[model samples]
Target: MNATGEGEAAPRQIEVLASVRGRVMCMDSAYDVDEANRGRDVCVNSSYCGVLPARFIAEHRPRAAIGMDCGVGPEGSAIAGLWYLEALGIPAAVADVMTAHLGDGVHLYHHGIVSFANQPALDCGVTAGMAVREAAALLLEHDPVAAAASEITNRTVMETTPDGRSVVAADSIAFGTSEDTDRNVLVTAGHTGRSAVPYLRRCRPFGFICSDGGRGLNDSGMAGLYLVEADGLAGATVDARRARMGSGLSHYHDGIISAVNALAAAAGVEIGMACPQAAHHLLHRRPPTASPVP
Candidate 1:
């Protein structure tokens, strides 16, 4: 993946993307696979050129995988994950999406469908533009593993509004728990998608700062609009390059505002504004949380 269309460097480490049935889905660039990641056989990678760091995969091989295609840039050599996994005798796929997505590459999972799959994935019926979840389902059906928490999911309390709303940073809405689920101003890394609504509904925050996942435009980026409808929660999006994994929630305090909903407009969250500035604006419009059926 060439550096075009991207702004931030991908995370240098791996993080948990999901955990089900003792099988964990992990996200990372390229790094040595230590005992900490021993059983993480399902992986989502961020490295554009993986030949050097991807050597670690041979030792801690994931049975199935997903990753950014890096737009097939620089003579298409940036498709590192696909090439590496193919030789390792595993099912693997890479996104046909933009380069910005390859940075902190997990965003590619949220926005992309399978554009390219190695021999193993093709045998399982994985194809270009197939929804990511469907691809994951195929992977889980084939292989599984587990690993310890690399650390706590990255999230932060950036500011407390004068009205007492807590503004926090988080990578995914999965962190949205019943304990601290409501009336929050969340700076998050998840994309805006209807498929993601159920997850955001769990968090049920008062406002959001999310990544556009490098596909921010038209209907593809309307997930946040649908999200605000859940409870009129003001929301906005940034680029994947500006944020990665949990850091997408905490790392990019200020960056371009890509999209917004009408209520977010009423609440002062505008499209095209820097996120830090937008977060500042929404602080004044804090409204009491309305009960949502979801």
Candidate 2:
């Protein structure tokens, strides 16, 4: 038995065979000799792969032989075992993908265990249970609280331009020091399909200038960039962040923070480098307040 209170034995394999048998029975060609021969071959193979080994242990009582014969070795045997288990209605457990950096190149790993649910595919870059665990751990390394805050405060808006062009607008929050306090607001909107650089240039016409996220531009929408502002900006930023995180707007490969940062940079804004926990608290820790600025 596994953790979920389900048996480790194969059960779904029987269900598959039952389904196939039902289909065969309904077919007019079921009486064909060739089909009959094929069916016999399938049954024999299924029995050899599925029923025989299980029955050997359950009925014959040859304990040592069962263990020895069932030992994992060649891929062919592993495949046979998998097919057998499938035939027997047994479910197998598979691994998840893992990503790792070694020197310069990235490495993919896989788990060895078999599973029916959550089965990792080839090219999934996972090979072992340990690899799946490690990948999960790596993902969790980012502070959930901070990620939540980031997601809430950043907003990505899509609009159509006057010239029949689709445009994307991104607004975010930024900090202002006493010396340069022009209510440091980052407002970046651009032609939707083009790269960030051209979009930044377009926004420049509307007093949206600055590239605080970084030096170069990333055309990939996967990047997180947001336009920043001051005044009611902090509150708006916090509120947005809270709303997004609460609504489950952020997701895998979405790069919410990266997009926010990119937009902030394009708008020449400065953002506070707060810890993820602190950011989360800032976004969700406060109560609602009425705003006079529209």
Candidate 3:
């Protein structure tokens, strides 16, 4: 059992769930927001209303956007991003974490319940307790706002092993690269959901860590860690409550390890360990044998 008295259940396998509806799109991560979806309505799985993520979404200029509420963390930081979108004149809403998987946008669209809506979204007829599909439809009724200027942010190289392996902090695993294969440790801010599996499989980083996203909805939030374990890649997740979500620097410096896959555990990662210490162990461990990509 975990510190919370919850058993470590099996992680469910899922795909990159997405759908396009005329001018509307549903995707699993905010990183997926791009020129292709610009001027469209979108729903993504990134924490609903996170400041950084909101800014990212705003850059794409979607007519409206929906995201996961992230359990509305400390001082309402989780939903605070909605205010940014509201100011941009874009309607935005967040799904209740309890009603949908935190990192799967298609699941959110089909099963999510709206927990909060910014003023602009409210004006668009989105309301608390509304179904995500219904809310997204309402968002479609609005027109796109001018895109926000994109920000320039770079990944941080947090630590380097004596052998030259580096620990890199990226806001999302989508930032991972082919060069990461067998060469680095990546600490990311996104959840360890099944949608993340492909990135880990493709990059095959020596080790990695991501947020547990409050372990929402049957602990589906950290589901990708187990899949990575099957590939012999060391992996673990930070407790979402211990650090700000969507900030990899926070995951590396302020996070507490909440779960560890068998491969990570074998490398000396334990639940409750400091994230930096776990990264140390992972950086020093030998890379696992390459596994076939799914």
Candidate 4:
């Protein structure tokens, strides 16, 4: 029984279901875009992915946020948005699988929702299976002013691919500046945001693996978008859905894009291909791939 209608029979539209103290709860039948959710308290996002959702928090700077986790499929990419928001020091959470969508949760339209919460959200008492109304209530209990957290950590080298190439994994794009050694492989949990291109250009890695970050409304064309635009860099981004790395980047998905550079193309890479296979074609020096590239 929200402003729209009753639960299970509500129409899909961008409606301000509730608002208070410049902090409001809003809903969009489609997705939670920044341009659409400026002063919202809780965002009832019907969208199913987290891939670039945090961009809005970075830009417009909302107080807190909530959305659907989209089941965090494949490589844990969907919830990457929650991770990013938490990293940005914002309290964010998402609805679980059984309760997300526009009208499919514990009644986000009426009550609050409690699903997957980031560390920041948890710190503020946001918990899973809680009502969205309850979650919003907890958010209101905290100071409205935002806090500053630490910057994302640098990329760390997890392992070598047995063929002598280095596998560098980090949370940010600062890896290209490593003066340690020579290794052509790079992996990161960060999205392929266009801003990372310049730093990566200065710290070139022949092959790159990045996170897609759920490709949320604000993130659709940004992840790895610009990095691939540059020349001579063979790149692939793990579906943010499958790019979850709680233990670290060792679990990065090995899928590469159909798009690649001239050098990688000449070495036999193709679109919609596995990143490991693509890397084998370009950076594999000593040991050969399964079939050996002829």
Cα RMSD for candidate 1?
14.9
Q: Best-fitting candidate, measured by lDDT? A: 3
Write the residue-wise lDDT of candidate 2 on 42-76 in tens digits.
11111112233433322321100101112333643
Clashing pairs in 3: 48-68, 49-81
Residue 56 of model 3 has an lDDT of: 85
- Candidate 2 at 253: error in angstroms? 12
Candidate order by decreasing lDDT: 3, 1, 4, 2
Instruction: Indicate the worst ten consecutive residues by lDDT in candidate 1.
Output: 143-152
TM-score for candidate 3, please give it. Answer: 0.51
Give the alpha carbon lDDT tens digit for every residue of 173-250 in model 3: 878888789889999988999999998899889899999989989899999999777677899999999987777888
Residue lDDT tens for model 1, 1-294: 323545654444445445552243535554534444444445666554345545665567655666666666664576665667666666677766652355554565555566777656765667777865567667656542222333334556777867576667765666655544656767777677665677667777767777776755665754655555656566777765555534544435645777776667777777677777777666556575557978
Off by over 4 Å in 1: 1-49, 56-151, 162-164, 216-218, 288-294
State the lDDT of candidate 4 residue by residue for 58-124, as single tens digits.
4655666776666678756877777777666667777765554454322544554566787677767
**Looking at model 2, which ten-residue stretch has the lowest summed lDDT?**
60-69
lDDT of each: 0.61, 0.24, 0.79, 0.56
Predict model 1's lDDT versus the native. Answer: 0.61
Most TM-score-accurate candidate: 3
